[model samples]
Target: MNEENNLEQPQETLGQALKKRREETGMSLEQLAGALKLSVLQLQRLENDEHELLGPATFVKGYIKSYCRELKIDSQAMLELLPEHVEPAKKSKMQSFSRRTEKEANDSRLMLFSYFILAVIIGSSVFWWWQNSNQNIEEPVTTVMPNQLESSDISPDLAVAAPAEETIIQPEADVPTTSNETQSQVAAQPQTEKADPEHSEVVMHFNEDSWVEIHDGNGDRIAFGVKKAGYIMKVTGPQPFNVVLGKHQVVDITFQGETIDTSHFAKNRLAKFTLPLTE
Candidate 1:
């Protein structure tokens, strides 16, 4: 019976209680605002009972609680002084705004997913069409007439003529040569044998641009520079040659008439090796 009577009695509002406590503590609004890390205008609005100007009922309740704590009073009892309908009216607009923002984000994600699916479908269709077109183009258009088929099925024992054996006349072992031919042969023999025995050829066929540097056993720089694509370079140098290549995959190196497989020796797209690779 006493609890009901106490509930029926009019109670001091939260703002009025907070203002009375602040005055009892001998603290100005500015001093309290600085202590609570709040602006003086917000403190004034809180003390003056301006809940509408404080943004939200939740924030207003928080400010009241902080003010109660600073004054060393019961924050829960102070919070209970707020009207029951205050939060419902004030928070409705915030809840609606939050819901609207969430809806917009969801819509954007759905739209992006729809575009991705559409692009995938379009790409798949194009690929399928291309495959079909290629198959259609590759198929041969061939037809066989009945008369041609009958002609092709001739009797095997009707004495079909065998193709005439080619006749190849064999040359005599000893053929007399003219004076000019004998002299030309004699001159060509020395020219062929005149190749330098001290030098070996290092050939590089470049399919892409690559920088190459080469040094022979004699410490002579035989080749150095950036070789362009499709350029075939041949350097004749002494054996046990030192070679360096920028972008080893771009160039095919052939030493002593054999292509070297230096791709495995490459590191960071560069290769360094010696010609006539030792065991």
Candidate 2:
């Protein structure tokens, strides 16, 4: 019956007792907090008995002892009445959970951004392909049959199109079909000619612009011509032929395809150059 009566009585919490003591000493929260060199929130939490919010048991006990000393209360008495401090394990778990949730949110945002960028790239590629295909489809057809153009009634702009001129294949009569050896064989055919076996002849090869004359020993004119550069002329006559040259340096004479040395007469520009046709 006595214990029940004790339980029924109004019990003062550790915070309420400290608040009463502080007020009796004529100390406000700010004054008490300033004298204790503590924050107003810290003092308020201590007075309100929010020991769990203030952190670990040792720290809360220290703050309470400081408050009691500042308010001139019993520090040991207030500490004995305070509740147990919360466990650090629970706080650690809460922090881990908060970090995990934040990390998950950031990962989700990154995945969504990646998906958005991928979708844009795919959409752009598909749009470009579609546009390119449409351009290919809309392009004009330029090739037509030659017979169709000749038989059908054509537009004036298209009628001016000469299919015969554009598509007609010319006959390859003079066109060389074989290799370059065939061309060399064809070029050698005209320069081949037989000379008389009895009386030997002289051949003059012209390499520049020069007036020349060639006559036999019988005073018969065999050849007389004005030759330009790269002109190959054959003036064949009897032995001891008289060969006149306007420019002696520009002419090259040969007997039986052998070069005749005309360097002895190199000083005289105009002279009768002799030809030893036999040897």
Candidate 3:
């Protein structure tokens, strides 16, 4: 009976086990989370094994590792249970990312189609104007026959051959402008500083409290501190940014107005990404 009871002892979950160990050491969740340098929600999710709430799902292992470190738990013992919590999330993330890629491909196709149609319209307009302008140009008037001139010359005043009226062909100020010329002028216009396509900037907005470290690819630190919820940060530097976030679920990152998808790193619950994959 004793052997059976020992064998049947209920096992504690990852969260419960971690919580138990923390309490044994006289530590609070907030304090533990703070010690881990992450948000309380992140610690809660880790304790509860709320895999669904963990962003990028891939970072679960990373966050778990950090949490285990904070509690001074045996990493190998806890990590054996990690696969069970991590696999389902990996599958879900794959499906979601695939769908997003499909949508982006469709949007790109639509934009290309629109540009093609616009080019055809402009080309046709230019061709039509060229044909019409050539047709409208006045041809030189042939000299009147001498016989015909003499037949109509009954009046001496009319025979004076009125000082060959000058034919000044001044270009009309109100002449219709061709689309081709307009397009050429627009293409030649210089772009402003803000309008440069390659202009680089990194911006991050936090949804909740999180710790952040901003650095360059070469490891030079730029900014490091705990940022509060709704905190907005913009960075521009001599190097590409390597950003590390304490928690990523509520954080937003952008490069020149484009939203960056960092879901792949969400599993760590902490997020690390480079603004440009290459400097």
Candidate 4:
């Protein structure tokens, strides 16, 4: 009965047994800590059975096992004496792996989202560039000055004539009058015209510096230039000439001796119309 009672008594904890075994091997705390690659504070905690201070239940179990290995003691026997509340090392490793996997999954989703945003930005940039390129191709503008005008733009039959000298005729007054009356009579007399009314095909009188381009029925550019103010130009081309004028407010056009009303066709200070303009 006494022997059975003694056998039923409580055994020392895993930490206490490890410490006793280490002392029997004549190894100091520093020497054991160095061999096990553990700090002296950690080794002291383990020897003192400070399970809470040592860290998690899993870490305490690992320290206990390492202590048994260095002391050359049986680890299985000592491990059985651990508290039931302590978790197993396998369970701890599995929990760590699960958390790492969750973190990696979140990172993967973030990366995919970043790629989606980048793709949208690139697509928008390319679309904007494409739209601008098409706009440039569709509407084209040409600028030409009189001095830089090419000979090819003018037809050979369309010769530019110089302005003729004016021959003023003084009307004879039947009776001598005041000087103001004489001046009024001279002002009433008309100045000579630069263009021939009966023979001219197309005539342009510029009130300011203006840009003009004319294409004939056969698509030939008969005359195009930036004409100076008070300048008169005559051009002979096929019927139904295509004309574009920049600053139409500063020009007058007469086709085949009939005045052209360009106010209806003017837009944003420019005019585009066909000669012999249809109603």
Off by over 4 Å in 2: 1-11, 34-39, 133-138, 146-279
The TM-scores of all predictions, comma-separated, are: 0.31, 0.43, 0.34, 0.36
TM-score of decoy 1: 0.31
Model 1 clash pairs?
A: none
Worst 10 residues of 4 by lDDT: 161-170
Worst 10 residues of 3 by lDDT: 162-171
lDDT for 73 in candidate 4 is 83
Write the residue-wise lDDT of candidate 2 on 1-279 in tens digits. 999999999889988898899889888999888887889998888879887778778888888888887767779988888877674768878999999999999999999999999999999999999999999787543323222222123323333322222121111225374899888775665344324422455666667655556766667766554455676666544566777665567778787567887666654355466666333
For 1-279, candidate 3 gives per-residue lDDT tens digits of 999998899877777777778789998988877787888998888778786677654677788788778778887787676535444657677989999999999999999999999999999999999988877664332223221112122133322322222121111223235778875665565344224433345688888755566775455665655555677877645346677666666688887667887766645355667776532
Error of 4 at 188 (Å): 28
Predicted candidate 1 versus true structure: per-residue lDDT over 1-279, tens digit per residue: 999999999878777888898899899998998889999999887777777778667788788888888889999987887765354554778889999999999999999999999999999999999999999787543223211112122223211311111111111223247688876776666433324434577788988755567777787777655555787877775677788776677688887778888768644445678887775
- Give lDDT tens digits, candidate 4, residues 1-279: 999999998878767888888888899999999999999999887777767666677787788888888888888888788776454557668889999999999999999999999999999999999999999776533434333323233233222321111111222335446688886775564232214332226788988765677776667676666566788877764567788776677789898778888877544445778877877
Q: Give the alpha-carbon lDDT of every model.
A: 0.70, 0.67, 0.64, 0.69
RMSD per candidate (Å) reads 23.9, 20.8, 45.0, 16.1
| Candidate 4 residue pairs that clash | none
Number of colliding residue pairs in each model: 0, 0, 9, 0
**C-alpha positional error of residue 250 in candidate 1 after TM-score superposition, expressed in Å:** 1.5
- lDDT ranking from best to worst? 1, 4, 2, 3
